[model samples]
Target: MSQFTTPPPLIEDDIVQLSYPAEHILQIKMNRPKAFNAMNNALNAALEDVLNWFESEPTLWVAVLGSTNAKAWCAGMDLKQVNLGAKTMWTRNGFGGMTQRFTRKPLIGAIRGYVLGGGSEMVMNLDISVAGEGATFGFPEVKRGVVILAGGLERLVKLVGHQRACELALTGRNISPQEAKSLGMINYVVPDDQVDAKALEIAKTIASNSPDSVMATLYGIRITDEAGSARSAHRLFVDSAPIKQVHSGENTIIGVRAFAEKKQPKWVASKL
Candidate 1:
């Protein structure tokens, strides 16, 4: 990764780094260390493309999102770009292209250092998250005369409840990773060096299961929330396509037989 004092081009080779570290896991690293991995217009566009590709890839079942810079996971949108009157800061998928989209596959955020503004919003959208001990999360947009628009406000309220979310959002104060975990914002708080490993462990565990089942499970959970009522949620869960996919798939049969034989199951379903 190259260091650029100025904004880089929005080409595939410049802003983001994509890798497959395990059988079915995609590792996406924000490579703009010089900018604290901030979401400039170009980086935003690049991330949108990468996430779209991740969604379409048949072999990839999970993703671990992280940044190459140790100083900050992301400092949010590039204020420099904003000051320059840039309008391309957002994409079809929203900030960093991942915050607003509904992904069928799961994304696990591996965070460290500063997670502020848009960075915090990205973490809020992750299905699971592992943060380094040094990680600090906040929504400082209020201090900058902005609001948490990229799904953070609502998700924070859901994760930490109304009072806690208001305290964080209105005050523009930062919280340690442990505090975040206590507030139900992240799953684990490990050492900085262990953040990636812990995230990978969780991602691989999900990848080892039936891809269709995993996708369906995620879809079921999200749909229930979207349904917003007991009856509606129950009906959505019962009528879910992923649930039907699991019942009709061979993975269920294989799992039952494997359990009876005291052996690990071989999942044969295609990626969803």
Candidate 2:
């Protein structure tokens, strides 16, 4: 049996709280409610640290990102901090230390209240999202005299049709959770109190599967999603190293034997 080790204690003064609610689930919460959980130098660094830790932990299977504030998930960047010459907003993994990172592990976002500007951009990078009934999504960068440069624009265009994405980007208007769901921006919209529960439910379902298979599936999906064409996607899927790893992993044999014996499988941690 594989021994599970506890993660290290989160650093003091961490604006983002990293906690393990379950053996395989890592929950990261933005903790600056007074500023609406705005992304500042401290918050950005804290988030980067959490993500780096998650990437290194082989036993962890999924991550859930959310905010502690009730009024807003995140109101976006802290202009005051930025104007004061705080440049710690961007990390090697992009905004919020998540947008650019390529990891086989999945991330799910639980959002409520306002998700504007960079908040909305961060959602674009998540594998899945669960929004509260009061959730509002928008790209208001244009209203602030800036462009949506955090990869939201391209993702928005692909998520909804080009026409709708253009309207949202140009007008800087917010959309209700229903509208966002209709546009395929989020996977689920539950009552405000149930947002976290709904996200956890989904995360648990993913975590119960074989880690190697889950990683291979997500890896293939991401590669194909980025390939931009049927021919390219097909080629990428065929050559995916993660898929090959899954086929050669012990978890595959364990899964088959468990299924045949009518028993639950004890999945091994995926090294891919």
Candidate 3:
């Protein structure tokens, strides 16, 4: 029983667009080019819907979150919308519907420009991120008399440490993609033209592996963020439901059999 009884509409108006670049790989593009892909209430709801569907559709093993327009991935919250009384910038999942989520599958970021405020916050929680050279990220909430409340504060501090997170969030200064990569906030920084390709390449690689194993691996790694201690995380990782499913599932045996036969394994969609 897949939870997603309805298939995605494939395109979500001018807010979000969905496509499959390869088998088992989904690309979610922010499409609000006129406002630099800024997140308003509609955008938040649309993104949340798409992501919820992606998570439920087990065949979709990995997703790349990016922008359709080159000028900016997201300019953060649409202040004009806010000024006009569109105060709701949140969904059930939080800012942009993805920032505060704990997604079971891998979500990679493909960003190049103007990843600011909530934009930067969304990137903070992605499993892995690839940015283009032109990408600039910052938390400018302080300057606007708001705060980064969408799980960015906790994840950013855990990612880059208290000192660096303080400088980035408190000062409201932008960091280049190169700086972000150096600080381990992002996995790679490549040419602007290759941002999406790089993210897709990684997604394909992940999708080629056993889906159950991949999901279990992601669960094992992400549990550390909430498990309190290394030992606790380790204990939870070994005993977790996802790991148990992977270890006992058909894919485990299939993987071993394929290895023994020296053949590329045909993976099944995970039921995590």
Best by TM-score: 3
Per-residue lDDT of 1-272 in model 3, one digit per residue for the tens?
A: 23344588554465798778788888999999989988888888888888888888877889999999887998898888888985674887888888888878999999988999989889888999999998889899999998888888888898899899899889999889989888888999999999999999999998889989888888888888778999999999998899888878989989999999999988776767
Q: Encode model 2's per-residue lDDT on 163-207: one tens digit a residue.
A: 999898899998898998899988899999999899999999999
Clashing pairs in 3: none
lDDT for residue 217 in candidate 3, whole number 0-100: 84
User: 56-141, model 1: which lDDT tens digit per residue?
Assistant: 76667889999998778988989888898877558878889878878789999999888999999988888899999998889999
* lDDT of predicted model 3: 0.87
In candidate 1, list every pair of residues with a backbone clash: none
Which residue runs does candidate 1 get wrong by more than 4 Å?
1-11, 269-271
Judging by lDDT against the true structure, name the best candidate: 3
Q: How many Å off is the CA of 208 in candidate 2?
A: 0.5
Cα deviation in Å at residue 5, candidate 3? 6.9
Candidate 3 TM-score, C-alpha based? 0.95
